[model samples]
Target: MSKPVTDRLLTALQAIQESQGAVSDTALKALSQARSEPLYRLEGLRSFYPVFREIAGAPHRLQICRDGPCRLKGQALAADLQVALDGRQDLDIEMVSCLGLCDCAPASALNETPGPLPDASTVIEWLDNAHWPIPVATNNLQRLPTDPYPGVDCRYGAIKAWRDRPAEDIIREIEAAGLQGLGGAAFPTARKWAFTRAASGEPRTVICNADESEPGTFKDRHLLENAPHLVIEGMLLGGVVIGASLGVIYLRHEYHQARRRIEEALATARGSGVLGPDARGPGLAFDIELFVSPGGYILGEETALLEALEDRRGEPRHKPPFPTTVGLHGGPTLINNVETLAAVTTILARGASWWRAQGRGEHAGLKYICVSGDIKTPQVLCLPWGSTVAEAIEGCGGLSDGRNLLAFSPGGASTPFLPPTAADTPMTFDDLRAAGSGLGTGALFVVGTGRSLADVLLAQAHFFRNESCGKCVPCRVGSAKGVEMAESALEHSPAPIEQALETLHHTLSRTSICGLGQVALLPLVDGLRRFPDEPSLKPLKGFTTGAD
Candidate 1:
């Protein structure tokens, strides 16, 4: 029999964590000896990833989100619930960063099974009775424009149609469609493929970055669960174009439901000759694998993800030779987000003109946006590119409880918050950026009146601070200190804290190695700049724009 693959350290660690509820010292010692790896390396991994634990805790564990969306919904819900269930012997309750289920604000995961946070009494009752709460259904997939074969059998039609065509032809169509990376970078999709194909490499890699852990972002999860076939076909086409034999979907760990759907779809594809040896043609070989992340927001960063896949701590690498030229295993890697790859299948199946017509004005193709926070009906919507923020809010049934809009986060936590006057801004990257914000990951977090702007802004900073991998000094110290200064500004005088934050933001923006630190203090800085006259923000007046 073939020997088991001992090189997959992260996979082995995940298996141990899954079966034992924690990676105890005993288990790590065994793993170190079995894999012939040092103990310090395993310890580093356990400390870096939040998913890994050194020892098991209470029998039942409940992790509640303490990020932007959940705070907006109910700032004290988690704390109150904790107090109500205090001194419990059998259960443990902890607040964590975004659960990536922002649509269900005040979300909780009971023993890693996510659901809406019920009353404390209900939880206590479940603990006493040993009856676990059923996880809320997360498979609310909507029909999106990117799905070319809607409600029909997914027979890998796009790949079959373009299989025999020249790679140049497929690249040209994608270029004509004006496709760009939808994962906030906005790099040209065709250019990335061309660079990888031309680069001097033997086995290029294609990665679908499904690790969308940004606060208020869950559209990728929706697509993976609903339209897995489209994403699979897109990856296969990319492999064929770039001569890559291996592709991986680096999915986040909390997305258990989406993971199931992807696995089912991958099995169907492999069984039908769409993936495997000779899958691309007579001589070409290509197949895709699903790599669940150990757990961290930094792993969503491209190079950081590369580090994790290679069985190391997830930390972003410096740029000079980008991933397209030098990537996974030191080979050319084409890394695109879930939305970008799924759209590729549509662009190639239907002509480029049809794809262009799906947008409004100058923008091309549809956009998947996750709308959450203070909205009446928080959900994911696949709208035409250039749709205004007001339109998206309308689709979500407007502000919750008939409250008037005060300010809005145009995108995920990294994006700056824009005032209500900017509600008419188009959701495109250029338009939102022109308005002093960005469509980062296309996550819209609505904030209605009466909400504490300072609380919301500080919550965002705390998230970046908490999720920082501490790989570099700038991000490690700066994020934590920035959060401290922001929190102090609320209680103490804001005069001294404003200048300190400005200088710190300047330092982080210039010296940080990755985007996580670069945009760590952006929300607070932007809130102070944009809402200087608001009651909650008046103490921090005269704030200048520095970090963007």
Candidate 2:
């Protein structure tokens, strides 16, 4: 007979504890024997969990960006080589969301190698020499047609269509659809539901994190505006899965249009029995309410979002007691990104394996990417995971002036830049990480010719400085110092600029508590590294330092 999973986990934990953090190979083997089921269960722990399945051999998994910005900057080609070589059966192939590495455009990776490179040159050299394979490339995958129901009222369209379906069936369909979260993390939806269902001691709560604060990413707003019902259905389904009676749509304040649309949709869903008690026939008792967030980039972080929901100042909390375990007024809460939950409706409506088969291998499914900056049509494009960045750009009618691309942010402002030399890499998570950047939120900010790298860094620095929540010391003081240094550099004080940059980099990267501070420094650091020829100092127009 097989040992119970919990017992196995306990045994493994005991061995690890006894070894003082260094379990022997034999102990590790025993642990692995015990870990099989937990690992499977853990696979669906969240969107980011399963992607690491392939990289379990390595101590860490690095996800890079091969989306629009990285592609325009030649990350696609580099990613392609990595995918081909790393696509072996033993290795995992994942196409992650953007990692805010557009400044380092054609980035590549050295996964689980541990320790930072001595310098940027060494990192680049290591990437250049890495043995990457040439993945089987394709042009572009076809997009699913928007399924807007005909003759249905705008408010009731989503609810009416799903009204007749059993909540369990809907949830099961979602589970079978193999839909992962789309909010950059790509967590499995079914697993989130299962965890929330089991973990919640009281009535569970569902929150849709619409705080799309990542610069260069606006796909959530598009979904909220155009397909509010889809998002609602997803939330409702989550409520059912977790036995929740209430749901909240936490949207950012700047998304006024989306908020309005969602409000109307909520009213329609409730009035028409798509939501509310006895929704859509009998035994369905779930409803969603809309709440607008006072806009701040930090509020988009999961824990911060929860705090904001509780009417507290928006700031992150310590984890280990993750949101899934305890959240939202000290109850078990399930929070999902706007895009991630939207995909849930489709998953529940469709079958998981069917959804899995929709895209190219590794990047197996559609990814809706928000392409902005330097493009003629800055619109959302839904394509398969393995599609190249060149394909997306061409599909969007190429750059505005056909100018040479300088750098692009594949994952938003925090992501490093990718130059135009690596444009053919596959847009898979593994491929992107192998390239050197991350596939963070799929926001592609393209930088074109004539844009000063220094100016870009300063602008981004100003944003971080303004958005710092004054919570942790690193972010609070580092962002302020960074802005001061950036301004001084703009006024020709190179020493202060360098000092500020170094301090900000260490504080944000090494000590900050959340993804916000860590990623916020990408553009600033990469700008200094990539644009050596660009003037680091600008003369002050009216000041004479010698006279002063």
| Top model number, lDDT | 1
Runs of candidate 2 exceeding 4 Å displacement: 1-178, 280-284, 495-503, 530-548
Top-TM-score candidate index: 1
RMSD to the native, candidate 1? 3.0
Q: 263-367 in candidate 2: lDDT tens per residue? A: 887887778777867763477577776765544677778898777565345678978688787887777788988777777655544446656777787555677
Superposition error at 363 for model 1 (Å): 1.7
lDDT of 1 by residue, 1-548 (tens): 11122447888998998899899999999999988899999988888898898878898998888888987885577778989899988888888888998988878899888877777888988888888865574966666667788555655788989988999999999999999999998989999899888888755888999999999999999899888888999999999888888898999999999999999999988888889888789888888889999899999999999999888899999897888888988888989999999999999888899999989988898999999999999999989988999999999999998799988998899999999999999999899999999999999999999888878888899999999989899999999998887666666755446667878988999999999999999888877777867677655553322211
The 10 consecutive residues of candidate 1 with the worst lDDT sum are: 539-548
Candidate 1 Cα outliers beyond 4 Å, as residue runs: 1-7, 135-137, 151-154, 541-548
TM-score of 1: 0.96
TM-score of each: 0.96, 0.67
lDDT of the candidates, in the order given: 0.87, 0.60
